[model samples]
Target: MAEQVTLYTNPMSRGRIVRWMLEEIGQPYKTEWLAYGPQMKSADFTAINPLGKVPAIRHGATVVTETPAILAYLADAFPQAGLAPAPADRGNYYRWLFFTSGPVESAVISQACGFTVPDDRRPMVGFVDMQRMMDIIASAITANPYVAGDAFSAADIYIASHLSFSTRVGSVGSRPVFADYIARMTDRDAFRRASAIDDEARAAQASKG
Candidate 1:
């Protein structure tokens, strides 16, 4: 029997990505929606996540937070889902997974906020800056069809998600590789279903506001 998965999330948050991942896993799970502000700050939600963040999941007694961590956990927890690469081919998997969740995300957010990290402080930042991160990513994707390799894996789901969001927000430039990668990811049925769920949730939340 499958374990019960209860996902605590917000429609407008990174929870969208986790929802998509859940769809790919093809498992039944429950979603608890939280409106940002007081709802997210509420003790009910904060008890599950000390930071009071969404995108946290409880698989039976196991509690996992952070989008990337949740995705990684799902891959291992549901081995039958086939979201992970074979043990021998996991190097690229870990590579792009952490890079996207860490450096690439930082660079995009920093640029979005109109902040720049000087060269002297580059060592402190994993990606250094937006341009450098783009250059590195362009080269990586150009070399491989997917983040992990030829076949789609959890890494592709994660990195492509960041690229998709960055594209929508005008943070990532109009590189053909980025566009093509996002196009492939967004076209999946899992992506469509997960996004539709969030869209409805977002609309309902807005109506109450």
Candidate 2:
């Protein structure tokens, strides 16, 4: 029998990324929507995640937390969905995927918060400046149709969401490549559906006040 999958998430958090991944994989999983504030820090939720973060999942007896782990696990578990690169492409697949989640995210957050490493220690930070990170990401898309090469794998889901979020937060400049990439990802049926649901959830929450 297939395992029962339960997703614990709050729409306002990084859970949105998990939501997008779920939609991309076309899976039927249960969602336990969590309210923010004290509820997230409750003992029950803390048992699932000691850090009290959103976007945790339970697949049968297996409990997975962290956004990147969830993405990678979903792709591997649902091979028919074609969410991952083939074994031969695993090197590059893992490379860019971690790059986006780690360095790219770190650099963008730093820049958005107006924090900077010591001028002499910049090279040790593992990411070029934000503009350079944006340029490298943009150039990657321009050079290849998707983040992990030609195939539209889960890497694109991660990368696309990062680009979209960065653009919205003004961390990424409005370069042509960035704009086009956002348009491409947003046009996807799965993304549209996920976005509509998110919008509806937000609107409904606002209506209660």
Candidate 3:
């Protein structure tokens, strides 16, 4: 029998990304929703994630955290879903996936928090400028139908999610390329399903508050 897969998440957190990926994989899994604050920082949840962050998953004995890592793990674990490209065709896959997870997100979040890298220190930073980062992203996405290749992959999920949030929060400029890519990547049943689940959960939380 396949080991049960369980997700520890809050609907309002980055767990939404994992939810979308799970929907894409079409797997039967359990979701353990934890409210923010004490619930997340409690002893039990901390055992699963010392950092007490949402979007962590346990596939039997295997525990995975971080949105990008979770997406990558799910894609590899369920190869039949085809969320990962062929190993030979994975150059762009690994590239954009890590890029978005690391430099892109770091830059976006840093800027959003009103922290800017000094111009002289740009050389030391992993990402130089927001416009430059956006341009690079635009070029990569335009080069292929998807970030990894002609077919959709886990990279798209992470990249699209990042861009969607960043653009919405004014961290990244709105561009036709980004808008089109996000629409194309998310114009699927999985994305819609994930959105609906999170939306409902978020609404319920608001009602309770």
Best by lDDT: 3
Task: Itemize residue pairs with steric clashes in candidate 3.
Answer: none
Candidate lDDT (C-alpha), each? 0.86, 0.82, 0.92
lDDT of 1 by residue, 1-209 (tens): 37878889989999998999989889899998887789898888888898988889999889999888999999998888889888899998888888888888887888889987887887876777577788888787778777788877777788888888888889988788899878886788998999999999999888988
lDDT (tens digit, per residue) of candidate 3 on 1-209:
27767989888889999999999999898989999999999999899999999989999899999999999999989899999999898999999999998989888889889997877888988886888999999999999899888999999999999889888888899999999999999999999999999999899999998
Report the lDDT of model 2 for residue 24: 80
Is candidate 2 or 3 superior in lDDT? 3
Report, for all candidates in order, the number of backbone clashes: 0, 0, 0
lDDT of 2 by residue, 128-182 (tens): 8887787778777777777778888777788888888777877788777878877
Model 3 TM-score on a 0 to 1 scale:
0.97
The best candidate by TM-score is: 3
Report the candidate with higher lDDT, 1 versus 3.
Answer: 3
Per-model TM values vs. the true structure: 0.94, 0.93, 0.97
Evaluated against the true structure, the overall lDDT of model 2 is: 0.82
Candidate 1 matches the true fold with a TM-score of: 0.94
Query: Model 3, which residues run further than 4 Å from truth?
Result: none
Off by over 4 Å in 1: none
Ranking by TM-score: 3, 1, 2
